[model samples]
Target: MSKIQFKAMVVTEINDKQFSREIVSRDVSTLPVGDILINVKYSSLNYKDALSSSGNKGVTKKYPHTPGIDAAGIVVESKNENFYPGDEVLVTGYDLGMNTSGGYGQYIQVPAAWVVKLPCNLSLKETMIYGTAGFTAALSIYKLIKGGVKPADGNILVTGATGGVGSVAVGLLHKLGYAVIAATGKPDAKEKLLKIGAKDIVLRNELDDKSGRMLLKENYAGVIDTVGGNILATAIKSTKYGGIVTCCGNVASPELLTSVYPFILRGITLYGIDSVMCPMDLRIKIWSLLANEWKLHDLEQNVEEVSLEGLNTKINLILQGKLMGRTIVNLDL
Candidate 1:
């Protein structure tokens, strides 16, 4: 067969004043050097993808680049004998959608080290449905559980509960039989959070409007925090004795300002969750759990499928905190 070309979303810098993204056609030869080439079926829209699309230099250092942190599909070409054509796989993080052109295309040439064989119980669409965001949530909950969190250990708190990470955390925590307290700035999301398994809804203002008294009344057993900042600090201070808090994002701000009172007095454990460079062994374990034990009750309820062309609007929606649940980008469509 002759060379097959595919469409990709490419970002271009327009002078110093503007940047633009457009669909461009290119052959597989244009991809960055790698051992495996994939025929992408699905990719998901993440906050980082939105940042890269809108010219966030920290997430994406270059223009004329494709941005997608998570992708699932079938192997079309492989130099490594470990993988052959037609084998299913998925790739997330580890410089993907960063300096490297990522899965916002019909094809992706990626380092074999960054790829994972799709678990047998999950399909291409189902894998992307969990995506990087869901994986991070799973990792967070895993750490909390490993640190001794349990269903009867009071209620678990999920901050930014309407976003992808928090939404998955709430669902998973609830599935594990924990009372979940969801926190969100949008009051309109209360009903949505409840449907997703939050037993209680705490307004953002109610949590962040504290007096910074070094510590507060013991409130939660554990917390899944995506919007780091005061919310994280507040949650830490309010956690019960021996409680764990897993923080994974800086959507609000990166700076963490809190005293050692919670740690010293309550023996609280603060865990930092990173999905990008997670160890392969742990990543496999988490993926297994996501596919089996920790599976959500309504995995498809919060999903909103969008085409590649629809990304421009959804990107803005995610950045504005107007979107809830997961937004899976249907690259094949």
Candidate 2:
């Protein structure tokens, strides 16, 4: 085999308070030894990547680290019995993008335990388009279905609907024959949200107040929430009896200040979703669903592709909350 040096987006902390990311050269041999090696074709940007790249010790403690949480590519090498060279594979949300080298690079060497055989229904580009954000959205919808939520039960609310997780959730839910009410902070995205299948659109500020009492109007049968803090509490209070609420992000705040009345009186179910450490069995099942019945045809409609050199612009855009849908990073650039 020939030796190769590739470029990767690396984040390093120059001081305890300052951190920055830049595309830098890395040797293939420098990657952490693993059972499988992937020539990463594509990756997706996520809020967590922003956190890790900006020196959030909670997501990453080391410097000079790549921060992509989603990768989809073909296997170049493998030592494990389950995978082989030339097999198309994808790896997301293990330790691949945290402290270990991740998909922001041209390659990633990861344990075979982290690889998921790519489903034939989607291409590598399609997989990263869904990425961690879409996976989390699917998981939330899956949980809602298991909780017996149905299209006719009532309107389903999706908060942060212009974001990756929220946008995908809205698309998936709308495709499943449910009435989706999308809430967004961006006034410009209303037509985009409606075009993706949302039945209604509302400004996020409509739900801004977290001071409402234990229960509200019993409006929605379920809610897919990506913004936490006050918005989460507001969603909880407003859900109908027997409603299910799935929450997965803390872009707002992690705190939950609310009464137990929604759970105790209305029999509401609040599920905490964690995509990073989800069990392998469940992960496999969800991926299978994404490939088959639960597949959203409009998935490609929500993606915006960019080159590695264009990443910093996107990072700032996402932080400013000006970007919508998913931002797919093309590493070949």
Regions of candidate 1 where Cα sits further than 4 Å from its true position: none
TM-score of predicted structure 1: 0.98
Clash pairs (backbone) in predicted model 1: 11-64
For each candidate in the order shown, give its overall lDDT on alpha carbons: 0.90, 0.90
**Per-residue lDDT of candidate 2, residues 138-186 (tens digit):** 9999999999999999999999999999999998998899999999988
TM-score of 2: 0.97
The residue ranges of model 2 lying beyond 4 angstroms of the native Cα positions read none
Tens digits of per-residue lDDT, candidate 1, 134-220, equal 999999999999999999889999999999999999998888899999999999998999998999999998888469599999999
The TM-score values for the models, in the order shown, are 0.98, 0.97
Q: What is the alpha-carbon lDDT for the whole of candidate 1?
A: 0.90
Model 2, residue pairs in steric clash: none
